[model samples]
Target: MKACNERRVCVTGATGYIGSWLVRSLLQQGYHVHATARDPGKAQRMLSTIEGIDRLQIFRADLNEDRSFDEALKGCVGLFHVAALMEFGTSVQENDHVRRNILEPAVWGTRNLLQSCMRSGTVKRVVFTSSISTITAKDEKGDWKPVVDESSVTPASLVWKTKNPGWVYVLSKLVTEEEAFKFAKENGIDLVSIIPPTVAGSFLTPTVPSSLQVLLSPVTGDPKLYPVLVSVHSRLGSIALVHIEDICRAHIFLFETSRAAGRYLCSAGSCTLPQIMDIVSLELPNWISKSSKVEFNRSAPSIISSKRLLDLGYRFKYDAKDVIKESIQSSIGNGFLNSQVEFKV
Candidate 1:
């Protein structure tokens, strides 16, 4: 296998959750990393999280803007497009904001970025931090399809997709993947979509999305949660879960393995919300109320296949429960949470 060591890599959203981890992992693997954040100053915030300080260089890039990515992508050998607007909540004033946050950046910014990559001739390939959400779509009769895989899943209309609150992030993911594929096809870019399911894990680095909310999940009705994740309080079902480190390794694995192409699903296992709570209950019973309803509402009927990764010899350090539990414990250890779970929601 060819390691991307000595490779000059560019990661958008380099200061964010997945992007931060990706940056750190690349640095550890000996890749010279150039990362982008909307503000170079805020990019410093990520320094506390990354393990390797000497290998990372922060540059300014915003999805909403056009010209900044050129310099960041100039010398990089590969691109990891991880930035996306994942805001939730419903206010009429910010409706277009949410839509454009993802659409403009993904559709427009990504196009220009890919063009720059080809023009620079330094980019050999691009690994997009895409989601399984792209698999969602509406049927011709106006029915809903939440299933995502190597098949066609039409997203809700671009406008409604952003405002769903629970799953708006997927809207951007769908659009991002669509645009990547379109751009790849038109300009001949080698692009791979990383489809991860319910990521949970020990936070080797500080990341916003890799928080307890992700571990506790079943979050209050907000736009950030994916629609496919709507199940709460019910019966036997599961949400595919993978540790954050495992997700990061998957990103690196895909980049190294020549066979890795198209869409690869990164998953550990699935567990019901109650099952999840049960695991956490042993550690933090105080957080989940005994009266809380832990039912399965919108869990997928099928489990995602990680056989591709397994065949490629990828190993997960934690299973679903252990990963979720560790995330909670890590948060507590990091002072993000106390040992006692006082969670009310």
Candidate 2:
């Protein structure tokens, strides 16, 4: 009915935000994890944080290299491919990095892992960590009331496009997931993809920003969006949101369930920008700029319904305001939001 608790699973990006949490969850479930990262030094940190877990193992595996995961995937029964360069601001986030970092690994790495899994014969299935961005959001803006789920009305934009990084990261996931689906079809590998929108909830570590920043800021105090996103901060809270752990749990649900193949939208509820601020301000008054007024974007997605996952009996821990408040508080408690943490946006 489910994978053996002793199943050896190989998790990529094990030192990253989502990756790190995924590693912990797998270990908790009695899964023996062979976790990987680009740097061996980072592996040491994972070791420290993940110490005392009897079933845990760590190694180095770069998404950019050719034979990077050869050793990592050798004998594992499952693979969690989570490494990706978010052009959120890094030079390598987009451009060649999309192909080298995301596309190659998400696409070709699946190919390589599939080959290894086929060779190893113990490999079961691959549960890919994807984003709601892959669902093709028409580049419009509006509030999706009673929101949550994958729908055609979703709004789409790439980070590399408007920001310094642009949409390369978004495009990379789209291309990679598409390729993964095609490859899985060809190889008959059980490949499942989990897509979440505007992810909230604190990272297990401080390496990345919550997806809410990219989604929320656009409609609130975003100078880049000046008139469009910022002007609508008053109404920004109505958009769809979900907690990161819920997103991760969705992947685990699919990993253990045979019928979980194909795509599933993962989300909790929706709120407006001001509403979101109202939630965060309660706990993170010092971190948030009280001076800025919240606005709503009529141009944003009307609603993102995660009813697909919910109908399947999956429950969410935090709704919009609760998730935002908990996430900000956790970050503050974790020292990521100290006065010393320098972040312009």
Q: Which numbered prediction scores highest in TM-score against the true structure?
A: 1
Q: Which candidate is the best by lDDT?
A: 1
Give one digit per residue, the lDDT tens place, for model 2 in 125-160: 888877654544233444235443444422324344
Per-residue lDDT over 89-110 for candidate 1, one digit per residue giving the tens place of the 0 to 100 score: 3344455785665466568877
**Per-model TM-score on C-alpha atoms:** 0.81, 0.77
Runs of candidate 2 exceeding 4 Å displacement: 1-6, 90-106, 136-166, 206-239, 285-294, 297-301, 340-345
Off by over 4 Å in 1: 1-6, 48-51, 92-102, 136-148, 152-154, 157-164, 204-211, 218-237, 288-294, 297-300, 343-345
Instruction: Note the Cα lDDT for every prediction shown.
Output: 0.65, 0.62
Question: In model 1, which range of ten residues has the least summed lDDT?
Answer: 227-236
